[model samples]
Target: MLIELKNVKKYYRTGKLNVKALDGVDLSVEGGEFLAIMGPSGSGKSTLLNIIGCLDKPTEGEYILNGKNVERLNDDELSEIRNNYIGFVFQTFHLLPEYDALFNVEIPLIYRGISARERKERAEAALEAVGLKERMKHKPLELSGGEQQRVAIARALVQEPLLILADEPTGALDSKTGNSIMELFCRLNEEKNLTIILVTHDEKMARYGKRVVHILDGRIESITLN
Candidate 1:
């Protein structure tokens, strides 16, 4: 399994009240699987994503990424795991408007202290993978919604991470542009064997994945394999 979660629980303490965002959830994601998580607001969908991505720790139970238990890792170790093993794509592009596409893609490599020449070369390769090689010098603001999202995808690819976690990746684009983005995801999954976990409210968007998981009231309602 690429990911394994056993009876995971995430609780939030707000003053005198305790809210359970995730209530004893158990899940697993196999390597090279394209999975989509769907849910209504407050369903703990995002919380689950955060936990799986190693961005947040579970309040209880075990979170094992690949063969290692994340609950045993310290903050610095977890950060290292996130940088070296996982890639994230957000709804809002999240690209720095001031930086060119190449520079933006180099940010993750910079954190890892990769040499400047290697970073540029790898970033260019990633952009080429996304068919944005010619747009490497353009800033985020200069690209269209679809192009900007492609740049974000390239940035994620630059790390060559084990998994990609995308939170509503197409929410900011129009229908046509969103379809293009989702299609790109499908192509990447087939061509690169990239393990992808995406969160979206759109059923059409969810269909792009091989399996769809539905969440409700902080619990998994169903899992449908397409």
Candidate 2:
């Protein structure tokens, strides 16, 4: 399995109250699988995604990613794993306003200590893969919503990660643009064997996945294979 969560739990302390974000959630994602998670706000979907992406730790239970127990890894180890193995696409795009498209895509490679030449080359290739080769010099403000999202995808791609974790990837785009982005993801999954775990509140968006997992009140309500 690419991801495995066993009886996982997460809790948040707000003032004197303790809120359980995840309650004994058991989930798994296989290689090359395109999975979608859907739930309303406060349903623990975001918490689950955070744990899977190594951005947050679980309060209880085990999280084994690619057969390694994540709980055993230290913060630095976890950071390394996240940088090398997981690619994240956020709803906000998260691009730096001061940087152009190519520079934004090259951000992750800098942390990897890649040579300047290699960084530019890889960033160029990633932009080409996302069909944004011509926009390399354009800043985020100059791009459309769809184009900005594509730059985000290119940034994620520059890492050549084993898994793509997208949280409401199309939230900022119109329906037409969102559908096109979904098509791009579908193509990537088929052509590159990318494992995608996407989280969204839209049922229509969730339908794009081969499998769907629904959460309610910090627990999984159903798992549907399409």
Candidate 3:
């Protein structure tokens, strides 16, 4: 299994009042599987994605990524896991407007302290994979919505992460552009064997995945196989 969550619970203390962000959520994902999580706003969907992506820790639960327990890792180790093992794609393409596509995609590799030549090579390859090789020199402002999202995908890919956590990846685009983004995800899952976990409120977006997990009130309401 690529991911395993056993009785996960996340709580927030706000002036003596406890907010149950996630309530005993249990989930698992096998390698190479495309899983979609669907829920309304404030449904703990983002919380689940954050935990899975190593961006946040559950207040109580066992989260095993690959074979290692998440709680057992310290801050630095957790950072390494996020850098080396997990890639994130958000609704808004968080690219630096000043940097070109190639440079933006190279950011993660730069953080890893990789050699400049190798970073360029890998970044270029990732952009090529996303069909953005021709736009390598273009900045975020120069690209369209779909192109910007593709750049975000390439940035996520630059690390060759074991898992990709996408939160409303197509939310900012039009329906046609969103479909194209989803199709790109399908290609990555099928052709590259990338294990993807996507969070979306759109049922049409959820249907693109191999399996769909429905969330409500910080708990899983149901799961369906596509």
List model 3 lDDT by residue over 1-226, tens digit each.
8899999999989998988989999999999999999999989999999999888999999999999999999999999999999989999999999999999999999999999999999999999999999999999999999999999999999999999999999999999999999999999999999999999999999999999999998999999999
Q: Which model, 1 or 2, shows the larger TM-score? A: 2
Backbone clashes, candidate 3: 0
Better of 1 and 3 by TM-score: 3
Q: In candidate 1, list every pair of residues with a backbone clash.
A: none
Q: lDDT per prediction?
A: 0.93, 0.94, 0.96
Encode model 1's per-residue lDDT on 1-107: one tens digit a residue: 99999999999999999889999888999989999999887889899999998889999999999999999999999998999999999999999999999999999
TM-score attained by model 2: 0.98
* Ranking of all predicted structures according to lDDT, beginning with the best and ending with the worst: 3, 2, 1
The residue pairs in collision within model 3 are none
Which residue ranges in model 1 land beyond 4 Å of their true spot? none
Worst 10 residues of 1 by lDDT: 212-221
Which candidate tops lDDT?
3
lDDT of 1 at 80: 89
Give the winner by lDDT: 1 or 2.
2
Model 2 poorest 10 in a row by lDDT: 179-188
TM per model?
A: 0.97, 0.98, 0.98
